[model samples]
Target: MHPIPRIGPTEAADRPRWSVIVPVHDCAPFLADALTGVLEQLAEDDCEVVVLDDDSTDDPARVVEQVGRDRVRFVVNPGRLGASATFNRGLELARGDLVHLLHGDDMVLPGFYSTMAAALDSTAALAAICRVEDVDIDSAPLYRTRSYRRGTGVWTDALDALAVSNRVRAPGIVVRRSGYELVGGFRTDLPHAADWDMWTRLAAHGRVAFVDEVLARYRRHPGSDTRARVLTGANVRERVAAIGVLAGYLEPRRRPWVTRRALVYATVFAARTSLSLARSGERRAAGVQLAEAARCLVQVPGGPPRISR
Candidate 1:
C-alpha cells in the first residue's frame, strides 16, 4: 500500500528539483483535487507546483488559490493556446530539473513524487513512469494500466514499447527537463498524439525508468481526447503521424524494421477497435476507424504479418 504524504506548502527554490505543471482550461471542476494531490506529495523544498491557466473560462486560478493555498505559482497564457501549445507554455515556465505535465483534471496517487524522484535519481534515466489507475469522473477506479516492468529500474526496450501506442499517461510520467530541452516541446500538429510522439522521442534518445507501482490516477471521461478523437478517426491517423516521429528519432538501420512493427501493431489495434465499435452499433465511427486501419496496414514496410488474437 502506498503511504499518504503529509500536506505541506512549499516555497521551493528559484531552481527546484521537480516542477509539477498543471495545465488548466475549463477543468476547474476537478482542479482542486489535482492541486491537492500535488501539494500533498510536495517535498519540503525541492518541488514547485505551477498552475498554467490556458485562458480557461472557469476559475482555475481560484482553485489554485484554495487548494494550493497560494503556494502554487499561477501563470495565465497570453492568449488561448490549445492543449499542446498550452503544455509547451507550461514547459517554458517550469523552473526545475524534472517536469511532470500533470493535467488539471487528473490527480496523482500518494507516494507518486517521492517514488518517481528516487527512481530517476538512482537510475539516472531521462524519464520515469509508473502505472496509472484509470478512474471515472467521480474518482472511482475503473481499471489500472498494465505495468511493463516488475522491478523498478531502466526499461531497456522503452522505444519498442512505445513504438505502436502510448501507454504512458501524463500524470504517470515525469521527464527530465534536459530531455525536453533536447527534443523541444510537444508537437502542435498531432494534438491527439503529441504526448505519444514526445514520449517516443524521449525513450528513443535516452533511458527511461519504469516503476511497477501505480502512482497516479488518470480520469477517463467522455470529454477526454481519446474518446472525442476516436469518433473522427483522428486518434488512429495521428497515431500514424506519431509513429513517423518515432522513426525519425531512430537510426536509419532500425527505422524500417521498427516502424513496420509499429504500423502493423497500430493497424491491428485499430482493426480490433473498429470491430468492437461496430458490434456496439457505432457504425459510422467504426467505418472511419476501419478505413484508417486499412490505410495503416498498407503502410507497413513489409506486408503485415497474419496477427491472430
Candidate 2:
C-alpha cells in the first residue's frame, strides 16, 4: 500500500476527511432520497456532503433545507450551469482530502463510505471504485453489476487495460483530491460522457482500485441522461470520441486493438439507434443509421464485425 497524503490544517479542529459532491438539476422527485442515502452512509466523523443545486426549478432548496444546512452545504448556481460545470464548482468548494461524486439520482449502499476509505488505505491507489447495481425509478434492484480490475504497475498499461472495456461506473468511484486536480477535473465539452473521459485521463496518472462488491445503486429511468443519450444516438458519437482520445494515449502496437474495439462498439451502437428509430416509426432516421453503419463496416478492415449480445 502506498502512503495516502493528508490535506487541510491539522490545527482546524473539525474538518471532513472526504468531500462528497452531488450535482442536482431539477431532480426534485429523487433528490431528497439521494441526499438521504448519502448522508446515511457516512459517519459524522468521515465526510461532508456538498449539494450543488444547478438552478433547479423544482424547489430542491426546500429538500436541502429539510436535510439541514449544517452538514450539507447548498450552493445555488446563478443560472443552469449544466452537470460538468456545477460539479467542478462543487469540487472547488470541497474541503476534504478525497472526493466522491454522487449523482442526484443515485444512492450509496450501506458501508459505502467505510468500504471505499478502506480500499484507499489498503491499496494506496489514486481512486477506489466499487461495483454499481443498476436500479429502477422506484429503487428496485435490476440485478446487474458493473465492475473493473484494480489498476497497478505502469500508469499507461493500467489505463490501456481499463480502456479495453467501459466498465468503470462514475458514481462508484472515489478520487483523491490532488489526483482529481492533476487531471484538470472533468471536461465540460463532452456533456453526456464526461465522466468516461475523465476516468480515462485519471488512469494515465495513477493506479485505480476496483472492488468487486456493489457499493452504489445507479438508477435508470426514461428521464436518465444516460438513457436519453443512448436513445438519441448521442452516446455513439461520444463513445467514438472517447475511443479516439484514448487511442492517442496508447502505444502504437495497442492502437489497432483499441481501434477494433471502438469500431465494433460503434457498429452495435448504430444498430441499436436504428432499432430505436424504427420503433418510433421514423423510417428516415432509421435509414440514416443503417447507411452510417454500412460506412463504418467498410472502414473496418475485415468487414462488418459481429455484434455482441
Candidate 3:
C-alpha cells in the first residue's frame, strides 16, 4: 500500500473529502430513494450532495426539494446535455477530493462512502470500486451482483482486467478528482461505453482498489439507457468504438492481444443480447442479434471460442 499524501489545512478547508453528484433525467420515481440513501451515509461535514437535473421533463427539482435543498444542493440545467456532459458539469461544480457520480435512479448501500473513501485514502490508486447489486425498478433485488474480482484488495493488472471486461461499475466507483481531470472527464462521443473508456483510461494511470462488498445498487429496468440501447442493438457499435479508444492507449505489441480479446467480448455481448431477446419473445430481434454476433466472430484472430452452458 502506498502512503497517502498529507494535505495542508488550507486545502482541507476549501474542498470536502467526498462530493456525491447525482445526475438525473426523468427519474422522479427513484430520485427520492437515491437522495435518501446518500443523505443517510453523509455523517460528516466534509461531504456534500449536488443534484444536477439534466433538463428532466419530470420535475426532478420537486424530488430534490422534498429531500431538503438546505442539505442537498440542486442545479437545473438550462439546456439539455447528455449523461457524460451532465456528469462533466457536476465535476466542474464539485469541490471535493474524491468525486462520486451516482445515477439518480441508483441507490448506495450503507457504508458505501466510508468503505470506498477509506480504501482510496489508504492506497495510491486513482480510483476505487466495489460490487453492485442489480435491482428492479421498485428496488427489489434481482439476485445479481457486479464486481471486478473476488475478495477485496487492489487490482494491479488494471488494463488486462479491463480487456477481459469492464470490472468497474460506475455507480459503485469513487474516483479522485485530479485523476478525473487527468483523463479529461468522460467522452461525450462514447455514450454507451463512456464509463468503460473512463475506467480504462484511469487504469492506465495507476492501480484501482476494490472493495468486496456490494456497496451500491444499480437499477436494471426497461427505462435505463443501457437496457434500452441493448434491446435496440445500438450499444454494439458504441462498445466497439469504446474498445477502439482503449486500443489507442495500449502499446503496439499489446494492441493485437487486446484487440483479439475485444473481438471475443463483442461476440459474447451480442450473444447475450440475442439470448435476452429470445427470452423476451422477440424472435426477429433475437435472429438479428445472433447474426450480429456471428459477424463479430469473423474478426476474431483465432476464430470464436466454443461457448457452453
- Most accurate candidate by TM-score: 1
TM-score of each: 0.91, 0.83, 0.90
Error of 2 at 154 (Å): 12
- Across 70-122, the per-residue lDDT of candidate 2 in tens digits comes to 67878888898888777778777777877988888787888888888887777
lDDT value, residue 163 of candidate 1:
72
lDDT (C-alpha, whole model) for all candidates: 0.84, 0.72, 0.80
* Total clashes for model 3: 0
Worst 10-residue lDDT window for candidate 1 reads 1-10
Clashes of each: 0, 0, 0
Off by over 4 Å in 1: 1-13, 307-309
lDDT of 1 by residue, 25-75 (tens): 888999998888888888748787888888889898777777777688899
Q: Candidate order by TM-score, highest to lowest?
A: 1, 3, 2
Lowest lDDT 10-mer window, candidate 3? 1-10
Residue pairs with backbone overlap in model 1 = none
| Candidate 2 lDDT trough over 10 residues, lowest sum | 1-10
